[model samples]
Target: MTTIPSIIEELDQLRPVSDVAGKVLSLLDDSGCGMSDLADIIRHEPALTANLLKLANSAYFGLPGKIGDAKQAIVYLGMTQVVDLILLVSCADTFKGSHSGYGLDRGALWESAICAAILANALSEKKGFKSTGLTFTGALLRDIGKVVIDQHVKSAMPQIMERVETQHISFMAAERQVLGVDHAQVGAMVAKRWHFPPLLQCIIRYYHTPLQADGCFTEASIVHLADAICRKMKISPGVDDSSYEEDERIAHSLGLNETVINGVIGEFSEKMEHVRTLFLAG
Candidate 1:
């Protein structure tokens, strides 16, 4: 088996997308970036522009007419949706691959990420949390570490599986025992390298266990819960036992009743095609 490089070394070798997301957010916040400005930013990338336009006109958006340009798309979709779309486009390639170590096949990771992101966004909306755009992006890419860590996990599969089978341990724990680091840590390191917002870095790192965070933002907790929910619902891409204890505190923090959570799952299931359409549309 090839030796997995030290976390710091591995991080140093990869490019971060957070800086790009930050710049995009800054431009959006500064307000000098109107539809024209948005169009200008996307124009240089024809593929992104075309895809954005496609999504803007998709059944998900329910627009009155086809969006002919990026400017029009942004105006109709609203800046928040536009930004979310851009972030989605930006992270597409990174999340598309299979992580066989985790049993994700081609497109499996992407589907899981999309489902988690949608649920995260839905939960955020339900809780009235602002920065829904950032929450959605963070949730979508939250598992990014899995991409990099899969190779190491593949190498250490035998030992890791042994632990999981015998110890009733989480896969992440097994991963740490065999590889010295887990996907969440590796993912957070990568997000930091990308210059992603500090909040996102935290979510990437701790979404699995958000109550442990000192500040314990409700948004992070929502994503954490949403990840577990997605896995439990079998929306996850790969084969996971999906057996993790719930953080009851998150439910309380968000004032989430079982009814509301159930409703969201029903809505999510109904709208999944819309979600898939946004990403998979030509």
Candidate 2:
């Protein structure tokens, strides 16, 4: 049986997010951190620097000229967007492998992560949310616990799905009932291990049940909606996809309705294609 303690021990054996990425996440909570501070940290990692420039100069940004350096990329893309790109590059490798446990073949989870991030950003913009970066980051990593618990879920799928089909419960609930934990809880643990901000940790932990996040309810709600939207688009869905339960009241609280959500879905489809080419096609 895969117990929570064993799962936590396994996290120690798993590859940690890169030091550069850790610094960037830490800087997000630092109000004193400046553009130069971010640029300096990114410059130390050649691959991250290269990826950031490439993403900044991509047609997605529609820049008139090239972004020659990290600082310049920040100037054009803003601190929030630049941080998002760096985190994406830093964390991309972990999602590259096949996760058969979750029925995600090579790169499937990565595509899903990117799709969620983009959708979250777009949704935040529509709602005039000031913390688009936080929402984007939260949505991007919302399913990371799946990566941690994938093998366990795979081995126990029989029991988990039995409950899902017979009990008519959400997959996450089934996961908790059988495995003693769910992906969202495990994902929040991963975020804490990665030294992410407390708000972000709460967002991940309570995204499936945003009202539980207390002060961070709105942010969690945004990520929940984004994840729900991703599933609705049927973008690289895994076995646990269909059982997701969206909170309609939370949607109403965010001032979102079916019409508004459908509009966002249309926008997501267009952007997903463009981003697929720019970020994944390489």
Candidate with maximal lDDT: 2
**Worst window of 10 by summed lDDT in candidate 1:** 236-245
List runs of model 1 lying over 4 Å from the truth.
1-4, 12-22, 25-39, 237-241
lDDT of 2 at 237: 90
Summarize candidate 2's per-residue lDDT along 1-282 as a digit string, tens digits: 889898888777768778888898888888888888998998888888888888888888998798899988888888999989887887788776778888898899998889888888888988988653488888888888988999999999999999999999999999999889999999988888888899889988988899888778888898999888888888889998998777799989999888988999987777776788987774
All-Cα superposition RMSD per candidate:
2.8, 1.3
Per-residue alpha-carbon lDDT of candidate 1 for residues 1-282, written as tens digits (9 for 90 to 100): 434466557666555554445566566446465666666777777877877887788788799987998888878877777888888877777777778888887777888887888888888888777553367877888888888777677778889888888988887887778888888888988877776667677878888877765543665788887887787788754544453667677888779888888888989989777777667443
lDDT values, one for every candidate: 0.75, 0.86
Give the Cα RMSD of candidate 1: 2.8
Instruction: Please give the lDDT score at residue 165 for candidate 1.
Output: 81
Give the C-alpha miss distance for residue 269 in model 2, angstroms: 1.4
Give the distance in Å from residue 185's predicted Cα in candidate 2 to where it truly belongs. 0.9
Query: Whole-model lDDT for model 2 versus the true structure?
Result: 0.86
Clashing pairs in 1: 16-194, 18-196
